[model samples]
Target: METAEKPNHIGRKIGRIRELRGMKQETLAEELGISQQAISKIEQSEKIEEEKLEKIAKVLGVTKEGIENFSDEAIFNIIGNTVTNHDNSSLLCFQPNFNPIEKLVQVYEENKKLYERLLKVEQEKIAYLEKLMKEK
Candidate 1:
């Protein structure tokens, strides 16, 4: 029998990544300014446009490439490698979860991008204010 997972199913990958981040469909919908049903449909899709994928990636705190390359096996491997039963020197397998340090670095990178975006907005506001001052 074939496995449930389909290769290069972008929508499924997005849904999994969202779940890994502890997000709900409703929450992701809100972040994307779309209806919850739309989010559901997206998760059911086999392909998504690159622009929409970029927006979703930004909201999910991951790179578009990351989402495109997501896999349950990769996650399991990461967790399986790190979590072990020291007493018996065997693997203590469980649900896949984040590596705190890796998550921190990812968050830091996202924050840096956010900061740059915010800085650009502030600079635009300043420019507008200066234009008003000059017009007065």
Candidate 2:
């Protein structure tokens, strides 16, 4: 069985390349003759079949091997290494880390709560400052 990491990497690559090429997910889906949802799934790193991978590679103007061998960690390293060395040509293309929908949702919720707390604190501080100014 393929590890979850692999698909995540492929999805991120698809997203990045599509963005770089100025292609929408809908457009990629059309070129691949798949649904927009399917493209979304691929971009989100959902489990996709081998044939779909081939189609994605073709549509994205990348080689099949390019898509097949990528892993999330590998892609992260590629980005990190390339930024440090400025030698993108030698960097092995990588897939992104597996980020499931559930995980994303959870993270979103956590962030939302944190943001809310920050806002409350700011409001409280402003109220205190305003009261002090009024008293003065």
TM-score of each: 0.59, 0.43
Kindly list the per-residue Cα lDDT of model 1 for residues 73-113, writing each as its tens digit: 99999999997755763445543587878889999999999
- CA error at residue 105 for candidate 2, angstroms: 60
User: What tens-digit string does per-residue lDDT give for candidate 2 at 1-136?
Assistant: 8765323466777677778779998999899888999888888874567887787888888877776565556768988886764766645776557767878999999999999999999999999999999999
Candidate 1 TM-score to native: 0.59
- Score residue 80 of candidate 1 by CA lDDT: 91
Candidate 2 — which residues are off by over 4 angstroms? 1-8, 68-136
For model 2, which pairs clash? 9-95, 9-96, 72-96
| Winner by lDDT | 1
Give the CA lDDT, 0 to 100, for residue 12 in model 2. Answer: 77
